[model samples]
Target: MKSYSVKELLEKQPVGDVVVINGWVKTFRSNRFIALNDGSTIHNLQCVVDFEQFDDALLKQISTGAALKISGTLVESQGKGQLVEIQTTDIFVHGKADPDTYPIQPKKHSLEFLREKAHLRIRTNTFAAVMRVRSALAFAIHSYFQQNGFYYMHAPIITGSDAEGAGEMFRVSTLNPKNPPLTENGEVDYEHDFFGKETNLTVSGQLEAETYAMGLGKVYTFGPTFRAENSNTSRHLAEFWMIEPEMAFYDLDANMDLAEDFIKWILKYVLDNCNDDLQFLESRLLDEEKSKPQHERSEMPLIEKLKFVVENNFKRVSYTEAIDILKNSKPNKKKKFQFPINEWGADLQSEHERFLVEKHFNCPVILFDYPANIKAFYMRLNEDDKTVRAMDVLFPGIGEIVGGSQREERLDVLQQKIKALDIDEKELWWYLDLRRFGTAVHSGFGLGFERVVQFATGMGNIRDVIPYPRTPQNAEF
Candidate 1:
């Protein structure tokens, strides 16, 4: 009487062996068949019971969403759908979900509706498939870094410095809210705060990871990063998990190559390990997009799209070239763009990135050497002194999936850039010390983990890909 999972039971034909399985009833039909699932896999186990032999009181307890422990002999299914099923001999009701109030009913649910019931949404086939694929992808990320000799560094969540000089930060404070200590200039006294100074949630781990790379040769960080920007779009999340890998003695070209290869490796890994779950998601996407206009639907299947990325070469273009292309493109010439690309220094928006990746190239595109003023201060300034050695990887539907750049290893140039950008010199003194000691060429980039999951799963909203999406004014779960 060993406990077996539905995945294990389905995979193996234990024809005459009695196995104990515990799961929640997905659907109970005709007082005999119980569709049970344990979140192990997308497939459900069909448990057949004899109504004539079972008492009426016991049968009444087996309802949809009810948790039950069922012990039965596995047999070849006489049914048409699945290959195997369970013959229930004894049952124990662990918990019951009253159908009157259970939110996850057996029906097609809207993604928005499912977001509200985030705790129980995993019971659904779509979310379960997504999470399984997500797990596989996570493993693939760590595997790639570990195999390539990169130290997996854990950057602190609470940081004393702003990696991105944008100043969009969520403060970490333990001071009194109503009446806190004030300074001589009538400012809130941060000297008595948690860290004895102003501290905030880390916006990026790239800066800290660079410090490790200088010593370890190569380093990576996969952890939660926060932002206080209030972008309430389908693409924006206040909190996200990012994968950043830094390497010493690497130039911008080497950084671009690593980023491209890393993405392809993850895609191939998921395709190999999570085929069953990916197949379910592919079918889900096809059904979900059936009602949409034919012109708007994807030309290729989900799996084919992923395979295409792995098989093909990414189009690499410089920022100056991209600007020239955008300014003279059919969309810009015809004034169809939402924000028309008119000049070289204009920051590329989502619309522009999509135009380049989906329309112009019809493939993944990596744009590099961005205008220095448009990028972060840490990016290496080019010989022209106007552009930085920055790069962004844009996918067909998801614009800017990955972004990274070569660091300004020269202390004099970096200090000047920080000063010109009005960043505090004292705050980044240790970062500058890396340059002082032995800074050679170093480069890195970060890719949002949730966005990659969304792409792999063909999920529509970014919120749907993450387990508990922390968006603006929405932290309910």
Candidate 2:
């Protein structure tokens, strides 16, 4: 008999056919029926076994979380919930799991508790569904870029340039920390480091991907990015994946178009490919009101809202317009934001971003041409000299899921901007050389992969979407 995956069994519905299935027992109900799952899908296969058919020793080993191989006949059920089930004829115990030692039980476990057992949390229905959605979303990302003729570029893990220019970096070195490599003048010496220069885990892959885009015309990088910021918010993660796409001969408008299209593609792809997993998420994990359609449910309105966004085109607005709308808003007129929102030059706060997308636009909104002073040095300065050609794609729930901009290709303008920003021009020689040789107008943006996953799955936290999440003061595997 050929071994069958749980997912395969569910699809094949091989009633009366002998099939072999191997998996860890999720729940063994009454020692006669076993719920087996191979981490293939959110649904588990319930195998009904007769105690008389199995040896006493084999029966004793069958327990929840135990690994087992069972040969059985599939039976179509006219039951309440499950579609198909297996009636076991032969059973073999692959491994025994001690109930006391196993952390997960067939009971409700809080998300915080599950984080502690991160290694074992995949066995749960919620985590399993999340993992499946995560996988589908990742594929969707690759597919979206690939279909658009974007070459998948692998950026280096260790980088010398601070791409975000945020100054938050995790230094990489094998040298002693107490008395690290230093010059005679007592300054920290990077010459003796492994790379023979200062190197840190890359904060973003945008700069490196730009070099490839200039050559390949269109390129994207999907890779891990590290941020050493000590933020403990539900949104912050120390290490996360970012999908950065760089396009040659593109401006801010073209970049925004790409971002919106990419988001829509991924959202639609996951919804189509992971229907079963998504259903499980909607029914079990998401709130009851959120589970029902907007035409039916009142509590969870985001579902209907997102469905509209995925189907329709996003709204595009300028920074000046957003600020003006916020200032004249009726609801938040008296509310004071952490970062003051004024005219064209103000940096939009998360609350402002959320309000603009959720209330004003009532959908995904792309806000562009932020003040140059608030943006990075690489962003192209607009003719106004006050704002840079930067764009941020804000969604209903999450704010600024994507951030990108057109590069300042003009050498003189870039050099002057770098000098004004006080960034060492000598350190970015290769970047400047791109301009020196053959620099064409290019644009790119970084989409927080976890944030995108959270949006697609309706997952509440950034940590839940990622496996073994790296957060501030939390690195437990």
Candidate 3:
């Protein structure tokens, strides 16, 4: 018999047809019913076994997590829940997972426990569903960019410059660690390094993507980026994936529109493609949030929250106005904020961003026109010289989903900013050449891919969304 996936067998195909399926046994109930899952879908395909026809040795080996190939006649189920089931006529055990020794069992395992067994976590329902959605979201990302006339660009993994001045970066070195090459003054000699200079993993691909956008008119990059910051928080990861899109001749307003549309498109794509996985995640989120206080829990369920974002327009406000609102907010008035919003140009924290999205606007909010000094030097300076054409899209659970701005296209302006910031002009000579040659108004944004997945799946920790998270002290597979 031709082997078929559990998902295909469960579909409304011809009943009574003999079909072969290969999968792991989720459960063997009363020695007659076998719940089998093949990772094709979240739902399991029920396999009915006739114990009398099989030897006790084979029956006893049909344990949870056991890999098997079962040939059976698919029939309409008379059982309570599922519509289709398999009457097993043959069984072949490919692998046996001892229930007592297997780390994953058919029970509710803690997320922390699952982390230690990251390799096997996919066998669980929750993690499997999460990974399915993650995959779907990734496909949606590529689809969105491709349909919008954006060229896909692959930025070099190893770079001699840091794209973002936000945090520390992981240095790429080939010199001997203990007795490294040193200069006459005892400083580490980077001239002897593999790249002939000090290089590190790219922190962002925005710079390279901008170069492509200058010529292609629109381009995007989706790749892994690294950082050396030692943040062990639930939301921070040392290694992460970033989605950056750069567009030529686009202003800040156009940039914001693109971001909003791109996010909504991905959300809708996941909704349409991964319905079963999304429903499972929605229920999982409800159960996980049960331990929290009523006020702290999300108002809408996971799927509803996603739909709400897709259906509504994000609220837009200026940084100056947001500062005013924060200064007057009840939390600021009662001195409940950890970092008080006492003055303009103060960087907003996660708490402040969440408050603006969840409480103040009760929707996604795009805060723009941040202080020039606080933003990157490449951002366009405003007329007042106090603010820049910067914007951040904040969601209810994900504080900063997207950050972008209008590029400083004028050659003189960019040169001045580069000098004032003390960045090596030689390192960015090609970047400046884009401005010197034929620079038009351009804009782009970077979205942390993991953060988007975390929000869509209602996952709390950023680590959980990624299959193998790379955090401060955890790199084990």
Candidate 4:
């Protein structure tokens, strides 16, 4: 008999057909029923076997979490629990998992416990479902961009320029940490570093992706981005994946449309293809508050929410208007924000963003034309001379998942902004050349991959969605 995948067997409904299945035993009950899972899906394959068919010695060693191969006939399961089941005739043991040592048992384990054993966390129902969703979302991301005629570009991991100018970067150097290369003034000599003249992990691929987008017409980069910030929070991670899509001849409105459409497509793909996995998560892993009603759990349930976002126009408010609203709102009615929620110049905190999308707008809101002082120098400055054409898409559960803006295509304007900001103009010669040669109205945005995963799967914490999460003061496994 040929080996069959769990997914294929379930879909084919091969009742009365003989098949061979191999996987690690999730649970072995009553010396007859065995739950086998290959990490192919969240749901495991349940098997029933006769004690007489196997040797007593082999049966004695077969325990929970043991790897096994079994040949059996597929049959309709009578139990209300499972769908397709196998009646086993022959059983072979490939490996054994000691119950005493294996941290993942049949019992319910908290997410905190799973985080400690990041190496083996995928064995649990929640992590398994999360991993599946993550994979599906990644495929969806590529599919959406490729279908829309966007070239995928790979940006350098180590670069000389800080794209975000956030000053949070992991220095890349082979020089000694103590008594390193120093200049005449006793300052660290970046010229002696590995890449020479200082290099650090990429904070964003936007600027590089723009170079290709301007040439290719439309380009996007999907890769790992590093940020060495020390804040320990549910959202901040030392290393994360980002999706940045840039396009030529596109304006701020067009950029917002792309973000909305792309997000909807991904949510639809996950809800449609990962139904079984989502259901497993909803019932066993996700919290009760996060679970949906039985009727709303169907395919595209989340997609419907996203569709509402795409069909309805998002509220566009200038940074000035947002500031006025915050300043005038009654203090008693306003929720406390981490950073002061005052006006146009201050960075929008998570609480303010959530309030705008979840309360004021009652949908995903696109806050555009932010104060130039708070935005990057590359953003196109509006005629008002105060705000730039920047947009931050804030969703209900996740705040500011997408951040992008129309680039300053005018070379003179860009150069002036760079000089005003005191940025090294020499290093950005190539960037300035793009504007000087054939500058066109262009826009792009960067979406946090982990945030999208958290939104799609209803995962509460950023740590739960990413495998081997790299966070501040935490790099276990």
Which pairs in model 4 have colliding backbones?
Answer: none
Candidate 3 lDDT over 331-389, as tens digits, reads: 99999889999999899999999999888998899999999988998899888988899
Give the lDDT of residue 466 in candidate 1.
Answer: 87
lDDT of 4 at 207: 92
Per-model TM-score on C-alpha atoms: 0.98, 0.95, 0.98, 0.93
| lDDT (10s digit) by residue, model 1, range 251-308 | 9999999999999999999999888898999998898889999977876789998997
* Clash-forming residue pairs, model 1: none
lDDT of 2: 0.85
- Measured by TM-score, how close is model 1 to the native structure? 0.98
Question: Ten consecutive residues with minimal summed lDDT in candidate 3?
Answer: 5-14
Better of 1 and 2 by lDDT: 1
**lDDT (Cα atoms) of all candidates against the true structure:** 0.92, 0.85, 0.92, 0.84
Please list all clashing residue pairs in model 3, or write none if there are none: none
Give the worst 10-residue stretch by lDDT in candidate 4: 295-304
CA lDDT, candidate 3, residue 263: 97
Look at candidate 3 and tell me the lDDT of residue 115. 94
